[model samples]
Target: MKTAPARPEAAPAPAPPVRRARARRLLMCRPTTFEVSYAINPWMDPAVPVDAALATAQWERLYRLYLALGHQVELIEALPGLPDMVYAANGATVVDGKVLGARFRNAERAAEGAAYLDWFRAHGFTEIHDPLHINEGEGDLLTCDSFILAGWGFRTAPEAHREVEAVFGRPVIPLELVDPRFYHLDTALAVLDGDEIMYHPEAFEPRSRALLRRLFPDALLADRADAEAFGLNAMSDGLNVVLPRAAEGLARQLAERGFNPIGVDLSELLKGGGNVKCCTLELRAPALGQ
Candidate 1:
């Protein structure tokens, strides 16, 4: 039988273009009350004087930059005695209009943690799941596309991973952070988008490192200098990545991967042991169907 002329081999379907801005709505707290008054993490030293005004100015610059990029930047009122409240990402891990409230391990930030849960409640997040385990909110719970990458063994509890998985209806991969400098997942890892991540290998345990490698074969490894500069504490709008001004190596690597790295000076905030991502928490409204 004469073979029907081979149909022109069907062209492989084009891969969907990577998008930025999937995590555009952000919740930020002003360094209006930011101060390194007490030591919590290794980055903080009570003896080192903090410039609150400069911190405010730098925070404003970062906030305005986010606004200029057309992202929703919401704010939380600063309360007295909560110096670390400026690290908004530690407040809560919000997804699908549900909040996994943070149960802070540190007594200093405990109240600030309560305030975050209340904020979620007042703002119409009805399904707030109280933590049975200590979790410093988005500080350890990094939301990727269909799953949440959770880090424990330092700041957060591994049990929080199971809670996150149940509450968010997403898989939660628990990675153990071994380095004191990278106490929180945000400090050692930056989720670029759904399919890719950039992280510091030495900060994680050997098993966690291997898990990261397997889970994210396309992961970008942050250089030691960049990691030490808190470079992994970066934020992405899908296209533009807002990061520390000192992380030039990371910025270049991001550029190579087709991401626009907008470096901003968060040195003042760094005194508090956080940077751009630390100061910002992404808000995914229920309407987004996250």
Candidate 2:
């Protein structure tokens, strides 16, 4: 009888794609004057006492963490009267080295717009647009790879979307937010990597939800628990994600997706209706020779 053929060898499994962390240039403010004196959003309740010291300590941790992660941290001096100025992401939206200065919807934050724009002007940013429409900077406008995803029906006016598209020369996809609790787009959604995002669907209108699904088919979905914990209010450098420690469920989901999730305690800052992404603003300067 003929000898049996040798068995075929098994092929080794392919290695997982390595995720990289981009070195970001971020802007942040010290929460030295943090307090919830007024109720602008549902999260803010002046009746509840705010721990200013704890908020400062927590903010410092986040600031130091950015430095430790090889990201450039820039500070815009915090104005005494403007308690919410600590949410630096609302100052401006920087893309390709161009600045779109914010126009606050509330009179309480009106002066902050001028302060931030002055900083950019003083720092040598020329291509700046002082928007005519009411917009909240990165709080309502988020940049993706080829387009800018904007949220309206809350803080940012729908007209602001058109102005941003013209200023950036990029396509703007408008998403309508319905929930009062998730007023700002940054509060309800966080961009993970290039064109990758994680969001709380219930925070948006039905049409906006459908649009999000169509745009980002593989986006991470966060439950109401995680959303309420300010989980979606996160900052990511592609591979590493910094979010609230209270968002245990989102952390697990991020870890399962091969992302390094860094948990931080910003509960004190939360009293003022802000967190990681709120405190940190990304400065997306163009690459040399662009």
lDDT winner: 2
Candidate 1 accuracy as TM-score: 0.91
Q: Return the TM-score for each candidate structure.
A: 0.91, 0.94
- Residue 273 displacement in candidate 2 (angstroms): 1.0
* Cα lDDT tens digits for candidate 1, 153-253: 87888877888888988888889999899999999999887768999999999998999999999888998899999999999878889999899999998
Q: Write the per-residue lDDT of candidate 2 for residues 1-290, one digit (tens) a residue.
A: 99999999998865544789999999998987779999888888999999888889889999999999999999999988999999999999999999999999988889999999998998888999999999999999998896799999889999999999899889999999999999999999999998999999999999999999999998999999999999999999999999999999999989878899999999988987889999999999985897
Scored by TM-score, the top model is 2
List, in order, the clash count of every candidate structure. 4, 0
Please identify model 2 stretches exceeding 4 Å from their true place: 1-16
> What value does the lDDT take at residue 185 in candidate 2?
96
* lDDT scores of the candidates, listed in order: 0.88, 0.92
